[model samples]
Target: MKINVPFSIAIAVLSAIIALLGYFIENSLLNQIRSSLLQSAIILAGVALIIGVINMMRVHWVEMRGGKGNKIYHLTFFAGLILTLLLGGWFGMSNPNGYWLYEAVVVPVEASLMAIMAIFLTYLLTKIINRRKDFFSIVFLVTVLVGLLTSAPFLGQEIPFIATGNSIVKSLLHLVSNGAMRGILIGVALGSIATGLRVILGSDRPYGG
Candidate 1:
């Protein structure tokens, strides 16, 4: 069974109403509703993540058992996940400086992964510049120039425009981050309403599945 248009429309309307109510009223009821909804959403997401972790373990466990691919890669993924959980869980999330487990284990793994990307990025930049030297190459060149100018003190003293450019860059960064986040939130809101409607109408059939 599929969700009917009528139910989807109803859910959209209800979500809109809730949003409006929260915006205008700012009452205890609305506050409670929002808090409860947030808590429930977080819990549900946590459960989903747990399921994902289990699935990852199961898939890789099979691969390891079957001796598929490089044993190094398989062992790396398994060890990394287990170590992260143990370090974060046992020592607490903050890790408290000098604990060393997080820095020693997690930091090195993260650095190793990030360091490999430099090779891929070099190839990508070469291809991009070769194909679209007119537009993309200029954009990439300008980005690197701005990055260097802002980070280095030498350019800032000689060129006042560098300081002004830094401010402009900061503003643009803020606008991009805020706009992208808002877009994501809006998409999530619509998706949530659709999922809620499907569950209510029994079309999703979580119980049956």
Candidate 2:
């Protein structure tokens, strides 16, 4: 008797069995096998990330050599990347210099970008209200304003009525926003499980084999 199987199918079957065994059988050897497999995956992921970064740098470097007008941006990117890596290597991540570099450089830049995004979102809301002028648009605008007011500092402290209103708005936001987030997470988890099942059953071949 002869048994023939595709290499991808064989690997998938083995992986699924090993994963199941790791989960269901609480044996020491099975736990060790699971840990080894996880470590191998992590190492492979790290290698892939490094390769991706090098490839991106090579592409940008090539573009700079081709006299791209965005050479300054590419140069700035490489400069930041190299500086951060060198500082991290030299000072260590927990060192004061590394912390200072992060607080002084990374935090401010991130905050500025977030501020810019908030401004853009406000502008977009204004445009939507002006153009739509519908019931839903009015409701959306009101909701956004209420949300912003609830988050604003000193508004609650200054006015008693405003403080009560902010409290109500915050309660509504927490209830609705948290419920929606939970629903989204549950949906994502279900989708992930279905995909994993498909992959394990050989119905899906993500590796193109």
Candidate 3:
């Protein structure tokens, strides 16, 4: 594929300038320009998402018309999707009926899926222990057990030691999860900066056709 060097460099330079202005400038005009650009980006994203969903629905509808084996699943998906959209459109999402629909239908479905995932994860852990009697396997099993036990309701109320253990587990979990999330975000930001610099230098041409 041939690279559109000029176009790519232009895009990268413009993006860098806009980003710098947004971050460093305190002028009202600059701030308004930044806000407008952000809003335009958001609007574009929303339109893209809608188009993607419509395309997905169209593909599924075609599959259903073709009498595929998964037609029933596709039908159910479209039915649920259309019903949810209709309800939300007719009555605002905050309306009693819409809220009830979400609470009564969506919440239970999501909860049921989560419950199933917990069972599946437990099964996988047991399988791993049975298959591998290694130190890491033991540690994994112990960690899973500790997490489950600490999070269990009512057990901490009855036992003082369990309450203390739960508090420690919660603290450790929060610290580890937050640290990992921050590391991931930092990595992403750095990667984006590198890519933008590459494009601006005309070393990379993502817009090539």
Candidate 4:
């Protein structure tokens, strides 16, 4: 059957209104409606995640068949996917095998990537500091250096009084980081509000535009 776009948009707008009202108002009916809407959203999110996994698998399968990419990577993807699915299905994913796979494979890869990211960000910050010799840039450069030193356990041990966890410099840097994080959170909140408004007005057709 053909879709009713207007009806869908109306329902979405109404649902958003109900959820918003439920956030501030304290009514049993609104609370129940919001709870149901949240459950539906969770279900839809899971469905979307499954669809995305299937799409990725299909793409990898076609590429594997055509020998378009590295066969090792393609086979590895399928092997990991099948293994995870079987393990999760059989043991409900709450068992030791699933935890072992995650800790052994996923954690190390993530840590390596984070190390690489730290190096890249440090390089980028250095470039910025070099290009702009402003007061803010200079302070930022010093703060980043202190943070890097503080994160190094061996070096911090050697320079205990300077970059140790209890050092005044580290405490100051922590406060600065908290202020910066709060500013970022405010910006994110404003951006989300703008996006939600656009979606509610039916101008942002995230479903199909």
Candidate 5:
């Protein structure tokens, strides 16, 4: 069926009104509404997290039993996840005593794994710059080099040229990043409003089907 334009407009207006009210008003009623929505969202997220963990465990368990020797790695991963979750749930994530488990164990392991990605990205960058052989590649390489040089703690403040180069690069980067981010946020907000209205209007019955 064709979308009911009038209905859509009414829903959009209602959403805008509610958002404006929440933004402008600082009263008990608005506070309650805001708190209720925040809490409901948190609860929904928790449920989604639980579902995700269960699905991951199930998939990995199957792989362990029926798939391959690489399955041992999956089993080890799930074991670690479960141990971490249990410890955090029981003792609290912010427990300073157990912080070592997160900082020392988790941080180094994850950082090393992620650092491998940088190597692959560097290889990809080399291939890309080699093939492109144009102003875009040169521009991209210069941007990356300037960013890296500025970020390096030792060279950052010491180098005279780094300051000027960093300023120019940062301005360009910020303009592009912020503009893209704003566009994405607008699209996401519109999509969220549309989905919420659809659910409220009984047009999307996820729980039913």
Candidate 6:
């Protein structure tokens, strides 16, 4: 027997609407339903993550056994994953060791990745500027330049933008961070709504697979 996809989508959409309504409504029943829905969602998300991780591990294990090129990358990945899990388990909740690993290794690695992204963005902007000298391109160039300037000091600036508590620098930092986050989140929300609508209309049968 085929699964009832329409029935499933109806339940999903109803549950979502109830959950949203619970936030604005003052009814106890609505809140309880919303809480149950949220718990169900969390469990489903956790299961999905576990399934994804297992799939990844299986694929990587097969590649490892193939004994082909770049075995070192496979070895490094398993080593790091195992090490991270061991550290987290041993450290428990009050984590000095886990925090140390994150600060020592992860932070610098993430920062380096971000720096590379900025470099690529600048390169892309140069291409855009050459192709089209538009208002938006100019704005993009200016934004990139300001972001780069505020991020680091050149030659150990004697005129550091240091105020009493460097409030000016902090303000600009917060402003930029908040603006970028809001813009990204708004885009995500819009895309999510569009995808959900597609699912609802059965125009996209993601569940069929």
Predicted model with the maximum lDDT: 4
lDDT of 1 by residue, 1-209 (tens): 35665556565455445654676787998878766766776898999999998999898889988998787888998887777777667877776633566677768989998998877876776577677858758777666656556555563373455545556665665577699899999999999989876765546744433
Per residue, candidate 5 scores C-alpha lDDT tens digits across 1-209 of: 23565566555455445554776788888767666766776898999999998998888888888876697699788878877778778788789654546886888989998999999998888787678889988877877876766656454464455545456656777788799899999999999989876765556645422
TM-score for each model: 0.54, 0.73, 0.69, 0.79, 0.58, 0.67
lDDT at 184, model 1? 100
Better structure of 1 and 3 per lDDT: 3
RMSD of 4: 3.3
Q: Residue 205 in candidate 4 has what lDDT?
A: 67
lDDT of 2 at 59: 85
lDDT of 1: 0.71
* Residue 207 local lDDT, model 6: 50
> In candidate 3, which residue ranges exceed 4 Å CA deviation?
1-9, 129-137, 151-209
Question: Which regions of candidate 1 fall more than 4 Å away from where they truly are?
Answer: 1-24, 83-100, 111-123, 153-209
**Candidate 4 C-alpha lDDT tens digits along 1-209:** 13677778788888888988898999999999999999999999999999999999999999999999899999999998888778777777678876667778889999999999988987898798579979988887877677777777653364665556587778877798899999999999999999999988888867643
Model 5 root mean square deviation, Cα atoms: 6.7
> Which sections of candidate 5 miss by over 4 Å?
1-21, 24-31, 89-100, 131-133, 147-209
Cα TM-score of candidate 1: 0.54
Q: Per-residue alpha-carbon lDDT of model 3 for 84-171, expressed as tens digits?
A: 8888888889898766668888899999999999889778878996899799889778776766656664643633444354486667
Candidate ranking under TM-score, highest first, comes to 4, 2, 3, 6, 5, 1
- lDDT per model vs. reference: 0.71, 0.81, 0.77, 0.84, 0.73, 0.76
lDDT of 2 by residue, 1-209 (tens): 12334776787777777876798889998889888887887899999999999999998899999987688989998998888888888999999885666888889999999999998988898899679878989987887776766666563464343335447667877798899899999999999989888888888877655
lDDT of model number 6: 0.76
RMSD of 3: 4.4
